[model samples]
Target: MKSQRFLKFYQSESEKYHGLRYGGLYGKLFKTLHHEALSGFLVQADNSEPILEIACGTGHTTGLLVKEGFDVIACDLTPGMMQRVSEQTGDQHEKVSFVRMDAFKLPFPDACVSTVVSTRFLHLFPADEQELIITEMYRVLKPGGVVLVDFDSWVHRWCWALPFALYNLLRYQRLAPYSIYNRIGRTITMASRVGFSDIKVDGIGGAQLLLPALISGSTALKVGRMHRRSVLRLIADQFMVCGKKY
Candidate 1:
């Protein structure tokens, strides 16, 4: 039932999400947050290897990963999203391939990928389906392969208290049929049950206080500084969980 709901949501919103400016802004913001959250883990990664991005929307994160020299297989259930990815890639990305595949039943052979990464997509899954997807991630990864999952952590207001509250309220208006503030520890526990090791969380996307003030430059600097400090993890809006399959 939950999987069916997700499929419907993806099919309905895929085009709107990949084409609009607000969606694009959200996409870039998500990538920035993920880049901050995963910097430590990704830096430790062997860049010469290939990685799989489950539920990659419009290939935003895939583009960043590719820029860092990691080959990427970007997968999503949304055909339109995959089309947008292909448009962005434009026949030049030897390091990236976009595919349409279900996370619950990954099409890859077992132990085939060096890393499996996801961003902003887990909360879309109901509890059981989330577990199933985690299991699939584990099944597809080689021993010692890293898995990085990122999602909204409900504690987002901890950093920039005022702005986060306002932004979230506004977001609530936009991201209909979804609340976004799901349990982080429960998700972590699910990963543990799926046989993941070395589980740890990273903070992504601190507070954007000056958005109303129109201080883009200062806000960008603050975002970067907060990321460097890993300050948001102390009270992160999103949690980036890193673990190993073995």
Candidate 2:
């Protein structure tokens, strides 16, 4: 029932979701790291096969994939979200195939797709479910295929614990779920259990809680970029995990 509600909520929110999440300077910082991390992992994917992007809300990643000239399967549960992707990638409609399906039980054969991606999706669920989703991603990937998933970090949020609490308090958010995959160790363990080899993580989007809110956009951009490659990246707010099925 809650899952259905989430789907319905995103159904109504599809039109405004992009602006709501990626509007201001902080938003730009987040989006920049997201695009950078996803693109970096994508270039390493097997170009000969199609890419399956789960929960492709509002088509941000979908647009990027389309622009890169790969055949893409942009799967989401909400009709509105898929429609948004259609509108967003208007010029290359032929390259993107929209499918409305649940990510928990992907409707595809095993060892079929070359690349599987899920962004901003795992952090929404509990640890066990994350394992299930990762297992599913692995099952569908062809041998030597790559899977990349990016999510919000618990450690990063905890680093800004006071500000996050105050921010949520201001919005009347009294409760939230915690992600156990807060660092690379837990994430790597999950990948190994799912039979994924060559598992690695890339941290991105740091300094959100520590940086001054009034800092200029360029400065924030630098902070975000620096965290992505720096040795201190694991402490950043968001990170991407790339694993291979071989």
Candidate 3:
């Protein structure tokens, strides 16, 4: 039921997604921060195997991965999103392969890819489901493989919590916000249970992330400084949880 709703939502809005998330000056600002946050994790992925990206909405990240010369298997449940990736890939077809996939049931063989990345996607599910996602990611990843996932910060969402929960409860009948949090302890435990090692969270996009685009240039710069202090983790807009499957 929940899966169907997500599929329908993405399928319907695939074409509009890029413009909404990566459009205006604000969009561009967030996009650059997003890339910077995810780039380090990308390099952590071994080049011996192709990088697997799950729930790659509209290929915004796909374009980045390919541009950096990594062969990627970008997977999304929605065909519309996959089509957009196809279009976004343009002449760089050989660098990426599109796969229509249900993350719970990745089509590839066991221990196939060296790295599995899914960002801005896992926080939608509850604690149990988030573990399920980590478990599934563990399955397809090679031993010592890297897995990087981003979560929406609970502190950052506090002001909007009511509307966020109300909207989800009303629209899809689900308000699974377990992954939206200020600390990485629980997430570390969640991933560790599934045989992940060296788990930690990295702060990206500060609380001022919602500010106007004109101010974002300096705000993005602040992310590096913000990440150094653990206290600021509460206000960060997103947290990147990175670990290795061992």
Q: How accurate is candidate 3 locally (lDDT)?
A: 0.76
Highest-lDDT candidate = 2
Model 2 has an lDDT value of: 0.79
Model 1, 1-246: lDDT tens digits are: 655666777677777765552244444554555665676788756677888999888766676677677888899887767666654555547778778887888999999988999977887766776778888999998897999887666666444556655765785454233535546677678889999988887666544423412456446546644643365455545677889876
lDDT of 1: 0.70
Candidate 2, run of 10 with poorest lDDT: 172-181
The better-scoring model by TM-score among 1 and 3 is 3
Q: Which regions in candidate 1 have their CA more than 4 angstroms from the true location?
A: 1-4, 19-30, 87-91, 157-176, 206-213, 227-231
Question: How do all models score by TM-score?
Answer: 0.78, 0.90, 0.85
Best by TM-score: 2
lDDT (Cα, tens digit) per residue for candidate 3, span 1-246: 788888988888887888976786656666777787778667787776778999888888778877777788898888888788856667786888878878877888889889898877887687788888778899999898999888877677786677668857875579953244534667778788999998767776653555533555675566544552377765666788889987
Each prediction's whole-model lDDT (CA): 0.70, 0.79, 0.76
Q: What clash count does candidate 1 reach?
A: 0
The predicted structure with the larger TM-score, 1 or 2, is 2
| Of 2 and 3, the candidate ranking higher by TM-score | 2
Per-candidate RMSD, Å: 3.8, 2.2, 3.4
Candidate 3: lDDT of 167?
A: 59
